[model samples]
Target chain A: MKKIISVLLAAAMAFALAACGGAQSSAPASSAPAASSAAPGQSSSVAAYATSLDDIKVKGELVIGLDDTFAPMGFRDENGDLVGFDIDLATAVCEVLGVKPVFQPIDWDAKELELSTGKIDCIWNGMSITPEREQSMSLSNAYLNNKIIIMTNKGVTIASKDDLANYNLGTQADSSALEVVKGDPIYDSIKDKLTEYKTYDQVIMDMQAGRIDAMIVDEVLGQYKNTQLGNVFEVAPVDFGEDLYAIGLRKSDTELTDAINAAMKTCIDSGTAAEISTKWFGSDIMVK
Target chain B: MNLSYIATLMPALMQGLAQTLKLFALTLIFSLPLGLVFTLGSISRVPPLRWVSRIYIWIFRGTPLMLQLFFIYYGLPFMGLTFDRFPAAVLTFVLNYAAYFAEIYRAGIQSIDRGQHEAAKTLGFTPWQTMRYIIIPQTVSRVIPPVCNETITLVKDTALVTAIGVGELLKAAQGAVNRDVNITAYAVAALIYLAITFVMTMAYERLERYFSRHQKKEG
Candidate 1:
């Protein structure tokens, strides 16, 4: 009987992985286009703009879209298990909302389309707030604080933002860091030296290999990478200003926007958010 | 480069390789026969059948495989059609490869001497018999080398499945790199891919020699 139970558990995990986050009761974080009890076409086509709390309740699950490759946020761990700060926080929020949280891994580039088309009800990843995002999507109130900071290989010194002019710099294209840097006067000083990669991982890799002298990245991801790589790089003395992380929902889903924000408030008030945050990041990083 | 870190990654890498091998094997099984059907369609006397096959070949072959994957997996959902991740990936790969295979088979068919057809006709054999006995067998041997090239390309193309969020060998390696913040996993992945292709190439060479042996003896 024990052997059978273990086999069943294994089967469930494999199904969760294969279905791309199908509803596996055990691992609340299932993988991609989960055939949710919600009738896909009926929900999107018939209602059009009525993705309210009731509709999600009828479906009985919150289909969250995320880029699974993002570490320290919604990424897989060393054991190939999906566990991160956002994943745990979302799970807590889902418990409060009384629905299972189904994590659907998505192409990060197409996240907005995924939201607009009703494929996923929300983008619950560690997405940062930017002017364009605020303009395009209905967003929750700030849940966590982050900063876009410059980091450099240990031997490379950058005493200030201007000191970056002496070194080769890199940041992810289309990332909030790039947005912040571009808007800063210092951007002009480092424009010739700046290179943009598709992901921070590549920048980290290049820095470890000694090709890039410095890279601009967010606090959670950059610090996580530094810790994992055994402090290959140190935070440069200068950084872009503070940034906030929030949940992204479709513009018409104002009802869900309010519901999620309320649930988040509940999670914060009860100290559950702090507990989960501490578990992942070693402290309460959630904005009180 | 920690030997221990790569050891820790083995289970996940093996799982990813299983997904890649499944996609590669299923694509070949479906596309090879599907290509023959398309080859027959393109050569049909009816213009509609020939045009349909030609256009399909043109569209699937001319467009990028990654685009087709996105269209089927993500794009089609908006239109009320949805597929699971693995099937969507397999569907895209099979259609894309079949088109390429169809063209290769068509070329092989056309390359046969017209004199052989005339000889088969003179011997009272029907056109169907001529194609079945005289054309296809010879074409199979002729197309093996090109087909092997496509197979090797298909092995690498499995990496594109990651775009649609399906885990495969390359994604596994990238996952490890992100988790460990190290590049050693990538070097190990490259070596594993090289090992797979090396085995596949040697197998294809053996199959090729077996198919073309008679021609070699004559030469």
Candidate 2:
């Protein structure tokens, strides 16, 4: 009887495990389309917006959404206070526009949703200006020149894009670096070997473990993290493409977009942008 | 509603489901036996063994699995112990689930009547024999239901692997959603989760029936 019970329990556990496994493997095929059919209209409702420059002036504060973990651009400092290049730039821009800057840390993935829903007046982190973004929201003229660069372990020899085919690369998911890698035709052959991480920090961790051979990241971020880590990694010569950083707002907010553009130009002409850049990057790398 | 759009997403989601299944299977395979060990240790008469088991269960069950994953994957490397993405995820899940399973095993084992042990001893069975042949066998039928619950929960919990960026089903769906600017992929992911749970429910029902057959005949 005892033998029967033990066998029964083992069998039952196996069966239960297999049950979930089988279900998961088979579920999406029959039900996914049905569920997705009802999603388009519901999600569309989340995209409507009406905030403008007048609204911001009357409100007397600009709520700027950013991923606070993004170093140098917008991240927490040693004292746990929010400070970064973009944070300073946004504060100065707010000053010119006669409003206070209220930094709102947000999930980087949902920045677009946060802006569309008015949870934030603008996304002012190291936000890259892509064509898709240009269609989705009002974007300021590019204020910072960024490029996708590959960073490999110091000992690894990556001379160019061709050398990357032999390596397992990683990049932050939903990031411009990932987009650039995916968009590059040269990566077509080895794209299968690439991994996407939630953050550059994770990619760096994986790189340290030798689990990944290289990571594609922005020059600004790559330089900042490498410097902070005492230059444990080296940059590869492969260039993906130019990525320009800009402020993102609701598409209807053209007036606010123009206002921010003017404010940005004022900051650059007054050398405030250069000062903030030098403070963070050790040199003025702003797009004047 | 777009058939072609979903069709395009199917391949990506399926790839993610494969990773999810692998994580679930590996977690169950390792955690179940380890959980049994912890249970035995918890019930042991040895003072240190019992305390160690108790503390292990307390820490694992008390904390969130997500934080545990972060600590193991990202935190431990600072102390010079780094794990690859998949291993880190599996290690965290196995350790966390083992604690919960240990408690369930402990309850099931303790519920067995003392008379059963005495009866086995009267038959010249050693203490180990009594547990192996008499106590554990009965405990199995009793713990199957809860163990089944945990197994199903593991399926959904595999989604948490996305935090460290090991693209499982939900993450794949999320990626599709972000890329396409549509929430339809999320809806599909939900349906996929529900379908898996439904199948798990049916499988458990069959197992329950099989386990209770003898009791039914006696009743």
Candidate 3:
């Protein structure tokens, strides 16, 4: 026992030495200034970030935060490479900005902190335009339109939003679809049946497992999943409402926000955005 | 069940396993010795050392590990100190596990018969020598089973690193499941975790045997 303890003590000393060298060398110098400097009681600093292309040019990369599980917008492929419309669009935008795009997969719950702490420059996934979001972050021009689509398991009945109350419903919590569903006139009727899961994929799984008879999801994701799943889920005839997808930037990042919007507009005009949109959605769904 | 699908996922899952193993290994390396220091501090005769160690253990063990991860990773930035995500995760885990291990060690050490210490003193064994040569050696054999239990828990607890965006194995499986719209990746991840814990269980068994064999000889 003493021999093993002595050996482990020796190894621990060695590990401590190696960790300081290897770990420090691997982390980027630019990412180290991640402190928010917000006073303890306050949530965030109100000081404007005085950065334009110069700071980004110096850093040489734009770290964009996103929830990588979102499909058709930004999600990993089978090879675990990031794909989907938003990623392609971001890559193109980064080409225009003369900086590399570094996609940082983040916890969706921590997106705002990621931006405020300078961990990521912006949230570039399929973020929906909401009043609360617009108040918190400077939103870019709405690039894509999404609808809250209701999907039910096969061999289920009826039509329209009224019939939705008859079946147990599910959706990802904190989703744009959930926001729309909660505000819908029929939500009062279906409120008892709605089950909010952590992700749309989980909601789809529950629908498949027969735990949930139907799932409310974003149209882009629903269409993508329906195509992929192949005859598993049926989209209800009634669409809940529309949601506009936009880029979310820290409120202080007005210059960066303008840069992204200008780049997006250029992509839409030059047919690049349409090309990527067509590839992902089978049509040009860009908000041109 | 689908061999081809599992094959497609192997590379990503293996990448994630590498990350899990790194965290698990690092936490074990740091926590084991650090835990011993706390155990000693917690059980010491000195008033200040014991109280400080007891307080450290109380704060860490009393709070949820997830909350600690959050405060360290997200909250600490307010005070101008910061750690990158993986480092923050490793720090939280090391600190949290060290507290638990301290308690476990304290229990094992205190359980030893007090007569041994008195005998060591009679033989001119200083306090340090009495602990080093008599008390600690005996506690080692007794502590093995509980330490094994804690070590096994650490294997599964690595999954919680996903909360801090560390991309451990379960998160990797989740990414695959989200992309493919299938549950197969989850099943594969479960098997992988089981395999790790199974190996750990076997190693601990061998360790227990080796110690007990020596323990019997000493007896």
Candidate 4:
């Protein structure tokens, strides 16, 4: 009887601990800034530029939103904490601006709400700058140039974009590739024939097992997956469209835009961006 | 905040609610029998059959449902199997919950007395007949509460299916939160879940009363 009671108690304790562990796992974002600041010269003089970017500088922090599952760009680590290339970039940008960075994991499709209501001061993921998106948000200069490539099973015979015409292409719904396929003139004939999924991971699985002909995804991601999948998949260099990675700021905050552009330039000159890109992507894919 | 936004979204949410209901309804229809088959296999006199059923139960019950969901939706296609989002979500849920329900059914069936089986045998009934007419009726009564509890859990567990992108209630709520950045939308979503759960609880109570009605009469 005592043994049975103890076994039940152990099971109950294990369950309680699991529940607590799951609940405490928050998205790993940079911690909020201290209520005070270090003395002058301890860090770069952010005060000189404070009057220019006063709205966010006065707030003493920038809330940056991203979908943390995108790798070589942004993703959660084993600890369930958000960490990746975009995370490193955001940290560096915040350090230069002398503001704290708070990370919020926003669904990719809902970035508009994450920005407009000030839940995040900016969108700093591998956000592609497009003509339509320019109408809604202010953007910095193109920080990196990327194009969508065809990731396919090695034995499948896709060599170029035209070779993929009749085949069903898999891409995440609402992603740049999906958008281009739906709206752009290039893919019009084949748009209706495509299968868009919620996650490209699902599509990649299909491609691996020959369920689909190819997956349309960013070139960098395609490279990462090719390396991970070993020789099972082949990446076609032929691309559907040029996707430029840029920082998205609210249209109302031109000062923040100018500030971020300056930081981008500094990071480029200092080789910080290239170093971070190498750390994650294993090569410097940074735009000059 | 506007009536029009609510008006537009209410229809969409309702459409999603229908899918949620379909997934919920079909999972019960399929898994209930599947659970019984599993129960029988697990309790069978044959060692290999019993062992296979035990391992199936152990694996499904031991892993995180989210990991199981991802493995099915993402990992399965690598092995050359592809299921549509709705079917994939439903299949995973049924397979997962069936394993859990099997254990509950087995416990209830095993709880019946050895004398009951012998009594049925003395009355010239075959072994299968004894199990069908004698063992199953009582087991049904014993397992109803646990089965209902699982169904309620299934309703919530269905939300994890969003990883495969079925656009169920919680995903809709996420869409709302992504656009607004307020907790009110999340709160409203929680209320929707609460409403579903409450209705199920009441229905389960009615079922328990209906089944135990015979016991009350005998008393």
Candidate 5:
């Protein structure tokens, strides 16, 4: 009886191993159909986009990717529900396109890969338009005017960019704000004292603790965080030039890009965009 | 593959390595002694002490260390306790590792022969003296292999602190990759890790040999 039980245990282990192997081998087989189905579209240069407007419509959902920690744009509220300016705008855009809006929170750093892999139909977050991004992704026309600004704890004072040389600064890594800071001529003097955090939230925390004297951040995000946190931060007047925020889609998704641009223009022109903007920012800051 | 590019990355990667080594060293220093205390507590005659030790081991061992780091660094601020990044990372590492090391120590202690305890008792050795002279010395040798395994794991696990933006070796490699859009920095980081583990393996082998020197030689 003991021998029989041992044999049965061995067989069970073998069966489990075989089952895992079968599942592993079948994963690629499952994706094979989707690739084969896209072969015809692949041959036609016109339908070369991994996903198209018609495809998204047929699917009945537009998966909009964003970093949910970014406030006033696409972030979670106190109740853990996603609510922000971009959240409202994307929903409106999806409404115009006649598809359900699906917000997929993604690692902000991996947003490009998310778009390329078709994990997200588009990045509709307050993504700043940059040359590097322009080369990689098909971007909609500028929808929001943004600027990188210096923010400090309420008592901390900084008058100009040159004054930044004296303070220990923080900025989010892989961010456009960091890019602007690094590009600035003053960066060389203060570069040694700069800390790159994973998110603006951490930067704000460090600022509150007096670990970092100031944070270089997007105007929209900095204002939102400052207001949300009971105005514990003071915005420095030092500007890092204008940065335009736009929607990012896969490079091949030209038709979808056009569709989104048109939809965005309609949102701006119809006063619906202004109403949404007013609801979030207390003013209609939507691009005319 | 570009030599100049690799050279440019070396400084940042070395800085990251320095941070990783600091974390590994500090964790080992604090966790090893604390682990011994925990092992003793878990085996104590007192129910409350044993239960506390057991529950700590259960919680730390069962949950992911990443969550602990997040809780200590991020979540704690909500309840009025806050720690800076490096301290929080080190504190979390020390706590998490002590639980693991405690289990290893317990296993090592329990594996000692019953005859040794009996002999020690017969020789007028008190419980404390028996543990100090006979049990612990033997347990050290028995535990070295598992302890070495855990030490190597600790070296790799230092990368998880990057979740809290501590910027250790792996995060530095990722930063380099992001900056240059090349993967060569990762290869460099991998080699650095390999060098560390290789040295650790050699050291542990020597330790094993040193510990087993008194064992009867095989013909």
Candidate 6:
């Protein structure tokens, strides 16, 4: 009886392991579309979007991926509708091309996946175009040059980045700021001192509760929260040096890239981009 | 299939397995005694104690562990009492499995023959001594199989702790998947879990045999 039960137990465990293995190995390949196939007869059809950019029209609507959590850039307003700077800029770019703008809220970590799988035509959130990312996608001229800033509760001052050493610094998981901190030459000096949280709000709450010493976030987002959240937190004077946010298109699709660049140029030349930027940001943020 | 990938992740997954073991060990350490207390309450002559214990055991056992875990992790933050992921996970597992252990204890306690109680009463032995000397010895034997079953279930159920981002084995596997955009790492994680379960099954069989052998010698 014991032998039979043992055999049964072994068999059950094997089956469970196999089932999990199957789920893990099979799902990724099936979820992605073929890398370079163009679809028939849709100006911005799935095929045109997938393969060559030349087959796509400049006038058809292009989908952009944005996360609606990071404030001032792209986030839900008080009415729970997606509203922010990215939305305004995307709307202006669409008007230039005589097409509608479609917004897709993407998971931050899966932003590359969304682009590769043809889920969206571009990533237009506060997406930092890193050199490593340059290998995966064709990128446009940068629109907004920004830097990350560290903020803390009022009356607490950090003199410099060196001063931030040994303090509990928080940033959103999978964020470029986290990558910069984790991969920096100075990371070894303070790597043990850092903590990553799932959301920015959690980091802010920890700062309020005196759990973390400070948090690093996009400068605009830090400024927006200082104005809006009605909290006692204030931004530090020192800023991390500038980085750029660009429009990302699949590497295989240059035609879509050309179309977007042309459309964006029209938006810039006609001052439509600046108008939209001022509406959202209270200043013209169109960069050279 | 991806032996190389599994080899790469083995160290991280081992750390996660350590956490899984800690949760299992600590929950059992606390819940086993709490379960016996619950058993005592359910069998208590005091009507209110009996009713309250019965309701607790019924509710914890009746509901699913997954739902209870979510309630502890997601629901508590709204009430202004937030627990970090690890503590919330351990608390959920302890509360949930303690109820199952309680039922096993109740059944074992009840299996003590009514005659033993009546006999002790006739001999002028106090109720407490009768329970310690007569009921406990007999109940211990019947409780072993159920305890073993609960312990095994608790091992696999540790994976649910990942839903709250506690970074146990399953979430470690998931984090690997998110990075590589491949799922095979999760399958490897399953095999690791199977290995642990296999060792535990062997140990449990050995224990059952040892106890059975001692019983036969006494008989």
Computed on C-alpha atoms, the DockQ of candidate 2 is: 0.03
Give candidate 3 regions above 4 Å deviation.
A1-43, A46-51, B217-219
For model 6 the local lDDT of residue B127 reads: 86
- Candidate 6, residue A124: how far the Cα is off, in Å: 1.7
Best-matching candidate per TM-score: 3
Residue-level lDDT of model 5, residues B7-53, one tens digit each, is: 88888788789999999999999999999989999888775577667
Expressed as tens digits, the lDDT of each residue in A1-288 for candidate 3 is 976875576456546644653343222221222221112211236243335667898999998898887777787776779988899999999998889999998888667667766678889999888766777677899999788888889877649888987888898877788878877788899999999888888888788889889888888888788888886888778888888999988776788889888988888899999999889888888898
Model 1 residue-pair collision total? 5
Instruction: Name the regions of candidate 6 deviating beyond 4 angstroms.
Output: A1-59, B1-219
TM-score per model over all chains: 0.87, 0.52, 0.90, 0.52, 0.52, 0.51
DockQ of 5: 0.02
Which tens-of-lDDT digit does each residue in B1-219 have in candidate 3? Answer: 799989999988998999999999999999988999999998887755776687678768876787677777766665577899999999999999999999999998999999988998999999999989888888888889999999899989999888667887898899888888888999999999999999999999999998789767868
Kindly give the stretch of ten consecutive residues in candidate 3 chain B with the minimal lDDT sum: B70-79
- Regarding TM-score, does 2 or 3 come out ahead? 3
Docking class of 5: incorrect
- Write candidate 1's Cα lDDT for B126-207 as tens digits: 9999999999999988899899899999999999988777889888888777777777778988998899989999998999
DockQ of 3: 0.22
**Across residues A1-288, which tens digit of lDDT does each residue of candidate 1 receive?**
976875576455544553542222112111122221122232234246447889888989999998888888887766778878899999999899999999987867666656765678999888888877776678999999888888888888889887989998888876888888888998888999999887888887777678889998898888998888778688877788887999988777888999999999999999999998888789888998
Error of 6 at B73 (Å): 26
Instruction: Please give the distance, in angstroms, between residue A15's alpha carbon in candidate 5 and its true position after superposition.
Output: 29
List the global CA lDDT of all models: 0.82, 0.78, 0.82, 0.70, 0.78, 0.69
Which ten-residue region of model 5 chain B has the weakest summed lDDT?
B174-183
lDDT of 2 by residue, A1-288 (tens): 976875576456556654653443232222222221222232244344567788888999999987665677876543336678999999999999999999876656546545544568888989887666776678899999889898999888888788898999999877888777777787688788899887677787789789998999999988877876788898887678888899988777888899999999999999999999889888898898
Off by over 4 Å in 2: A1-48, B1-219
- Which candidate number maximizes DockQ? 3
